[model samples]
Structure formats: C-alpha cells, structure tokens
Target: MSYELKSAGALSGGTCCYAGSRLPVRGPKRDLDSPYIAFLGGTEVFGRFVKTPLSDVSESLLKMPCVNFAGVNAGLDTFASDQALQSVARSSEISVLQLLGAQNISNRYYRVHPRRNDRFLQAQPPLKELFPEVDYTEFHFNKHLLSSLQARSEERFAEVRRHLQEVWITRMQEVITTLEGRVLMLWVRYDLKGSAAFNHEPVLVDRSMVSALLGSTMGLVEVDVATAGIEGDFDGMIMGELDFPAAQHMLGPKEHARIGCALAEKLQGLI
Candidate 1:
C-alpha cells in the first residue's frame, strides 16, 4: 500500500499537514542485529507530497531497519522539543540528519504563541516581533512575514538569526554527540538548480555552522537531485512521476524511488 496523504482540512494534531503514510517502524519487526537507521528533518524528510517515503528507499536498499522521524512543518525548535529526536537518540544505530533551509528558524517562533513559547524563545521579544503580522487564530509560522522582517531590518534580523542558528547548531551537536553510532548528514531540499524549475529559486546552502558541528565526526552525503536533471513523463519540479495532487512537497514517485535508491547506496557504503 502507498503512504497516506493528509491534507489541510484533515486532523493535524497541532502539526503541519503533509503527505506520507504512517508506516510501522521497521526496527521492532526486524532482528536485534538489524542496524537501526533514523530519518530526520521536516516534511521533506517525511516525504511530504511524495507518494513513497525516503524510509521506504532506505529499507529497500540497505536492508537495515529504518524509522522516519520527520515531522510536518518541523523546524529546529520543533525537532528539539519533539519526541522523535529522543526516539532517535534512544532507538537508532545511525541517523540521517537532513538539515532544511534557514526559514525554519523563523518558524520556530512564529508558529507557536507566547503562552506556548519555550523559555529560550520567550526571552527574546524582538525576535517574536519579526512575525507580528501573523494571525495566531490557527497558528502558522509566517515565512513571508519573517522574510519581510529580514528584508526590513537586516541588522536586527542578523542578530536574531544568529541566535536561532546557534540554537539549531547546538541542539544538533547535542544529538550527534550523544548518538551511540554513525550519523550521516543528509542535506535535502527542492530543486535549486537550472533556471528555477516551476518557480523554484536557487538557494545557497550556508554550511559553515554545519561544518563546525560535524568537525570530522559525521559522514556527509549531499543529494542534489533537484539539479540532477531527471526529466519525468510529466513536467514539474521533480519529474512528473510523483503521485501528488499538489507539487509542494518533493520529487514525484519515480524521483522518490531514485532518491531511495541513492540513499540506500550511500548507506550501504557506510555500513
């Protein structure tokens, strides 16, 4: 069976609505010797909008039991606070830490309200002010608002950005340091290559903080499939092979299959 796709109107459980089936974690069913692999990141890691998940690929390729811990609309803050990260720490033999873009840092504060704010974020008012226009009725991390704030007050934004960056880096370091086994840093994102397919703007991934955090401790694998140029039967960001009602999430099914294959190959090399 395919992974189920949950839309905006569906039950959200206080999280963003993204696609992917709720599959049974492979760890419990497999033997104890089965290597544990944990998938980490936001919706992209969850295979949002992609019919088949990356976990499916990993499982098929490496024959290691894999559990996908990616949460919808999850930012660094969410990952730090969520049960998934803890699960990764306690359960996995290896982790694929997929660091998403910088905008998620803004989401850390914008999505949650003051009453629900974590102490670290509550301490900074100006950072909260960055997303002032967001309507909190049904809370959403207003990316555009935060982007506008950055555009308006470059200096102040930089200060807050630095704090947020540090938080993410610190939390990631904590996870990596405490992990019992191998940790692979997987940098995943939408197509940022060519003339911006389907309006995808090129993003420059600043890996300075990530580099410092790894410091020869973690294995790095970059899958720049967005620019790898795999054309599909249909036209879209990834080829039109993904079974998506909307193409907001990831490469289609064929692309996801390829991603799975690639991930498995890399993981096999590590194993």
Candidate 2:
C-alpha cells in the first residue's frame, strides 16, 4: 500500500485542447473516432497529484476508453458555459458529471471565469450592494470572496449561499440537458452535513438540492470520502513544495480507487 510520492510536475499527462473546445483539459487526449465515455468535473476528476484518476480506473475495469475532460480548479460552470466542450462531451456514450461545490459558479452576486470557474471575475451590483462596506477588489477567488462575505456577517452570508444553491441547481439542469445523453452524477465529499454546509466539499450543496436535480441525471453515485476513511490518508500522492497544501486537501489513490469502483458499479449496465 506504500508507494513513493513524486513531484506533481512530473506527471505524464499534460493538458490538451480539443479542436472546438476553448478550455484545455487533462491530456493523453483520446481520438474521437471511436466510442468512449467522458468523465467531467473539477480537480478530483483531473486527479491533481494522483497519477491515475477515477476516469482511468473505470476505463481499466470497463475495458473501454474513458476520456477525462476535467481540469484542475475547474467546476460545473466551466463545462456549462463551454459550448464546444459540451459538444464533445455530448457525443460521448455517457458523461460522468462530478458534483462540485456550488460556490465556484456564477450567481446573482458574482461572476466566475467561464473556463476556470474557480477564478472570480468581478462582483456584480448585488454583491457590491450587499457588502457595501467591503472592498471587492481584494477578492480574486470565489472561496476568498465567499469567506470574506461570511466573516462580515453570517446572516448576510446565508442570503449569498441561498442564491448560489439556487443558481447551482438551475445551471446543473442546463448542463445535463445540454449533454442530452446518459449523464451519471458523482458526489464525492468528506462530510455529510445533512444540510448545505460550507465546511464540507461540494461546498454549499446539500442533499435536498441534489435531490432536486436527481431526476435529470442517469443516476447518482454518492461517496463519503471520510466514511470511506480517506480524509487524512495521503499516501500514494505525488507532489512538490507548492503542491503540498492543495495535495493535502485532495483525495489520494485509495480514495480515488474507492470512488472509481463505486462509479463503475453504477456504470455497470449503462455503457
């Protein structure tokens, strides 16, 4: 179970851009001439410091090509806004959509970069009006903006959270509809806060919100990374000094394996 950790920069697959897609995705890009399954989402789907992602693991078990279209720090909006990437994913046999956090996407209060959903574009009038006393220029990331807003006032932060949750549901549905095929939903989290909890991964998304979107998906594969006991387990991951902080928060090989197996099980008869 003990594997040597290497530098994150040493990973083999570099990102590549498809002809029509605007965003660069994790590479070892597949030839689209043949049928293949597409796995879509953010950092976890991209596998970060982990060598083999769930997409690769599932490919080995299913005996088919699984194209990983995820990017580091990517989120739902990254795909939701990309018509080209959506076209590429729509053509796949099925697309595995990772249920990333709600805060990364654009809402009434703020805007995120279309390609990199984690990047905060600019706060809208609503946000400026809500947090009139706070200087918006200081925020360059969605999490930073959200955290600052929360720190300002919990009562006001609830309003922002509610707006994000609503927008997330609508945006997810649009993405699912845009994909227009067997779209499997994957939920990998370190906690089950019962309600929309910010401290948990898939930040600000709760069971009820997922339930609202469930009918649109092929099915849902929910994994509690902590319950599976992979929260603090960082063995098998390769990272350098800069990669350490993020790597620590990311799920490792064992966790990805468990997720891959669960996803493959849900994917059994579909593909």
Candidate 3:
C-alpha cells in the first residue's frame, strides 16, 4: 500500500522507484522523468526480495534504463483503473504489462473485502465476499477438497470461469487501448501449492485476448512462458505458500533475478 522512491542517480543519474510493504529500496532515485524501460506486473513483477529489483534487470540484460510500476497484491482490475492508466500514460519510453490468471481477475469483479487507503486499492471487492450466497469455495479452488474435480466439471466450474474470463478480456482490451509507446503483456500464472493450479487455461485465455487487442494496436509485444510448466522442478520460483520468507505473494531474491532477467530479454527486443 505504501511506496518509497529510491534513485540510482549516482550511477545512471536516473531514478528508480521501489515500493510495497517491505524490503523497500534505499539505493536509487526512480527516474520518473527520463525515458525508461518500464515493467508492469503483479507481485511477482514487483519482485518481493529481488536484490537488484526488476527495474535493474535491464542494466544487466540490455544495458538500458528501466523502472517498475508493479503494485503489490495488484490484479488486472488495478491496472485498468484511471490512476494506474494515467501513471502508464505519463511516464516511461516503453511499457511491459503482465496479465495475471483469469481466476485472479474473477476475484476482483465482486466486492469481498474492505477498502484500504493505498495506491493499489481499487474500488472493487473480492468475488467471494460479494456473493456470499454463492459458494466461494468453488471459486477458490486452492482451499476446497473437491477443487480439482469441481474445476474439471464442465457444467459448474467452466460456466463461472467463462463469465470471469469475459471480464478479464474486457479489461485487457482497455489496457491495450490506453497505454502509449511499445507495450508488452507477460502472462504470469497463479502458482497454487507449487503447482500449475489453473493449468494453461487462464494463460490461453490471456494470450488469445491479448492477441485480439494487439490486432487493433501496433506496439503490443507478447511474452510467452508466463506460466511455468508445473511438472518441472518448482522448488524456488513458486509464488504462493509459506516456504517463502514472508508474504505468499512472492519468492526469494534469486527467483526474482531470474524472472527479471528473463523479462528483460523480452522487453529488450521491443525497446
């Protein structure tokens, strides 16, 4: 919710703003005015304990200037807001917007929690809390025992997922239309229990919708491998779970660097 800005003025004379709950950067001034390679994403792109930070990834990868606009606990809803859009419109030379899972987007459609005073706080609520009458467990497959089966059922799970996906698509379309400069979408998946919880379904939806939106615009770049293959070793890079030091939203610094570097390569081509 609270953000602190640090600038790397000594080295690049450019500022680097780092925000979020903890591990706030104390090194550099975030070069808000200068042309930069911007990374937009949720908590992962925010880089929980990333020693170098996602913004700094370009320094190693492309030797270019970059900044991070990712807000903690942020979803597509937050990105689609006037304030978020304005932030994108006002700054940076190139932008990378990471689209999260469809289920995570669905969670934002209904009001389920109280409002917080923060830049990340949009006016929407959690899906579960908004419709108490409807079983929230169905939506939150992570906690439900019958989650796997329920999600597999075409009649029940697929129907709800379809509606949520529609909302996701609409918001993505808005993002495509609004941001100026070269824009790329990194389709990051939601890691539940160190596994690919939503499968490739949400990633597919994001890719398809993003492609459609890009057809209308010229500067949109797409990042594949947003969702990691679950069968592979996922010991370190998993997003959720307490294995991480503090919050469930991110992983260790090592993973952040890896993700950051990988992302920088993708952004390097566009910028």
Candidate 4:
C-alpha cells in the first residue's frame, strides 16, 4: 500500500518564530516553554513533502514535543551561525541532529550561501588555484561545482573532499558543544547498501566518518531505509512539479514512521 498524496495547500501550516530569528520555521507550533526535543538537520529533518516529519512522529510516540529546527539544504554552519536557534536548542531537554552532507558547509576551499547552504558563493584562493581553468562564477550550487571539479580530476578533488570532511567534523563538534543536555546524532540514508559513491552528492559522510566524528558519544543511531520500500509504501507522497527536483529523493511517511520508531526506542533511557 502507498500513501495518498495531499495537495500543497492542504499541508500549509503557519510559521512560528524561534526566539526572534528572522528565518521562518515550519510549524503546527508547539509550546516552547514546556520540555521538548529539538530536531536539527537538512531537508529530511524539515520534512519537505511529507505531512509528518520524523520529529513529529517521534514526538507522538514519546508523548512529548519535538521542535523541528531544520531548513532546506541546512548545513552545520547554518545552525552554528544562528545564535537564536542555538539558544532554543540549548533549552531543549535533548536534541536529535541529522547528519547532513559535508559539501554544503563552508571550508577553506569554498564558501556556501549562509541561509541557502547549497548555493555556491565564491571559490576561495585554494579552490580557485585548483581549478584555474574553470570559471567559478558559472556555478550555482556546491554539488554541481564539486561534480565538475571531480570530473576534471579525481586526484585533485580528493583534496577538496578531505577539507570538507575535516570542516564537517570540526563544525559538528562545535554545534554539539554549544548545545546543552544530551544530543543524539542521527544519520538517515536512502538505502541499506552503505554510503553512496564519491561521485554521488548525497551520503557524503559515510558510516566510518560518523563513527570517527562522534566517538564514544554512544548517541548515534543510523537508519538506512530501503529505497524500493519507500517508493512502494508511499504513493504520490513526493512533492509536486513546483518543488525542486531533489525533493523527489526525500523520505516519505512510512520512512518517517520507521525513523520515529527507532528514535523512540533510542531515547527510552535518555528522556
């Protein structure tokens, strides 16, 4: 069986203000004064097309509120730079941080737009030197630029990959340190076939990277949902034509439910 598709108009819920942060947060607004869990990450955490994200479903199962602080293409830098969002996350009883791709975050090689982490801003000195032949201005997104760079020369692109991994680790550590209370790092992927190939954009940070970055935290829960299962389980659940092409890759209701169940089980002792 598959989920019935709901029109975009039907899923429209008014936005909520998180501590005066100008960025509009998706909501069926929950009370912030009460004890709650904070969910942070990129598109999947934001639940782009699905009516109920993992955070909401997890909240229902736990009989507690979960505040979704995710944004489209959100990187570690996006959350780290937002003081207000950090304040809200610190106040939460616990946090669930989704492991996003490393490419979106800014590093020594390149910079991404602050709000729209996917948008490529400018190539720094190192990146420019690496790809002097190519015009950086021609690129719009980090993934596209990286793909082009990789296609040009895999050996040189390895250096770019290394920088991103380092930056991702450092930023993740910084975010975790800034947040108060217990923090659980969650990794959700398309399939159980392990990480995606280097040529692919998604799953930039694989299982080994996750283990290395979050050593002894004992708070990481990796969820690898089967792609075929998601497609079979949820019919017409993806976003409409107006939505970005990437939206089609996001998790559906059944996948969210699976994630929620895992979270609820994991948080049994913590909260």
Which consecutive 10 residues in model 2 have the weakest lDDT in total?
A: 190-199
TM-score, ranked from best to worst: 2, 4, 1, 3
Off by over 4 Å in 2: 1-7, 191-197, 226-232
lDDT of each: 0.52, 0.82, 0.49, 0.76
Question: For model 2, what is the alpha-carbon lDDT of residue 110?
Answer: 90
Backbone clashes for every candidate come to: 3, 0, 16, 1
Candidate achieving higher lDDT, 1 or 3: 1
Report the lDDT tens digits of candidate 2 across residue range 1-271: 3334566566666788875786778887789889999899898888887778888899889888889999888888988888888888899999999998999998889989887888898889988888899888888888878888898899999899898999999999999999883799998887532343246888888999999988887899998885223355566666675766566667788888889989888888787
lDDT of 1 by residue, 1-271 (tens): 2334445322222232212223222121223345577776655566544445677677877777776666655545454554535554356677787765444443344333221222122213454576555343432433444455566687866765676666667666766665543678876555533342122311223568768766634577666555223343123222234434344334555555666777787788775
- Error of model 1, residue 15, in angstroms: 12
Provide TM-scores for the models. Answer: 0.65, 0.91, 0.61, 0.88
For model 3, the superposed segments whose C-alpha errors exceed 4 Å read 1-29, 82-85, 88-90, 106-109, 112-154, 189-206, 216-262
Q: Which residue pairs in candidate 4 have backbone atoms (N, alpha carbon, C) closer than 3 angstroms, thus clashing?
A: 3-235
Model 2: how far residue 131 lies from native, Å: 1.5
Pick by TM-score: which candidate is best? 2
Per-residue C-alpha lDDT of model 4 across residues 1-271, encoded as one tens digit per residue: 4443445534556455688775556676667989998998877788767778788889898999888988767777788788998898889888898887899898898889886788999899988898889899899988788888988999999999988988887788888888842689998876432342343334478666777757635398888764424365445354444553344456777788889889988987788
Task: Give the candidates in order of lDDT, highest first.
Answer: 2, 4, 1, 3
Candidate 4 stretches with Cα past 4 Å from truth are 1-10, 191-202, 216-218, 226-230, 235-247
Give residue 141's error in model 1 in angstroms.
1.9
Clashes by residue pair, model 2: none
